[model samples]
Target: MFKRFQTKLLQKQVAGGYRLYTHPANASYVEKLVLSWDTRRLTQAALETLAIIAYKQPITKMSISSIRGVNSEGVVASLVLKRIVKEMGREKSPGSPILYGTSNLFLKKFGLKS
Candidate 1:
């Protein structure tokens, strides 16, 4: 479909089908100035916890807290709520603590191939 001047249309997968959105067409030829208002952010603690989970995934909460030298329960919960990390399964330890790993959303958000 067509769009306004200096803009291009792109398709994205929706629940049932594809949806079209506008994007800049003449990126190499045009210099556009716009305000930066991107919101979603992560704290230092969250970032540290995320790095640990990304590198050494399928790990338990205690393991993460032990490695980080602080309680990571809140950070992990926030990551899960953000859909970046997920519950993979339970560890075979005595308590059978839940194991956490990155979600598909994390892979896509970071542009990493599964």
Candidate 2:
């Protein structure tokens, strides 16, 4: 099945020997998937984490927790899965924690220019 997809130009190889593809004639559907927020609701914790990441990005999880007064690892993971936030990179601190930031999709969903 995978070979058939490759032969039909439905998939292409990328770095690290991975395959990437998009559904043909589904740009609108893909856009909806990326931009639509009405289909799912975010928990309050997730929303708070997202707000912090958007304003204080590229911030570390520890910093976010410090501001929110709680650990936000799970909330951050949810935001990452929702494509609202992304892992920017690791910080230069003691543990080299991952930095988080809002994604381009987040900007699009919120109708922001930048």
Candidate 3:
């Protein structure tokens, strides 16, 4: 059983419930491993953008870019594409810019309470 799970990531769907993804091979190790079933990998930019969104939710993309001191259009778009971040609504300020926030998937993935 260990040998089978050691070489590859594993995923299984729970009966009448959500899906489960695990990496048994990293059970005893210190670092967390990304399983194969994940829809998208979290890169450095993704992580930074996610942290900003998670902390300052309902924020505008302009704010995110300002905070990061770099253009985050691609990162934010990819996060939205991955269903991790979502457009909550539009800001009441100039241009009525779109507000971004962490989604339920982000909450579950990060083990955070909504």
Per-candidate TM equals: 0.64, 0.64, 0.64
Determine which window of 10 residues in candidate 2 has minimal summed lDDT: 4-13
For each candidate, what is the lDDT?
0.82, 0.81, 0.82
* Superior by lDDT: candidate 1 or candidate 2: 1
Candidate 1 — which pairs collide? none
The TM-score obtained by model 3 is 0.64
Q: Write the per-residue lDDT of candidate 2 for residues 21-112, one digit (tens) a residue.
A: 66566667776786555614788888888889989999998899999999998888878867889889999878899999999988987889
lDDT of 1 by residue, 1-114 (tens): 234532565678999899866565645333233112121477999889999999999999999999999999999998887778999999987989999999998898788997
Instruction: Name model 1 segments beyond 4 Å from true.
Output: 1-40
Identify the runs in model 3 with alpha carbons over 4 angstroms from their true place. 1-40
Q: Report the C-alpha lDDT of model 3 over 24-70, residue by residue, as the tens digit.
A: 55564522222223654689989999999989999998899999999
lDDT of 3 at 47: 94
The 10-residue segment with the lowest total lDDT in model 3: 28-37
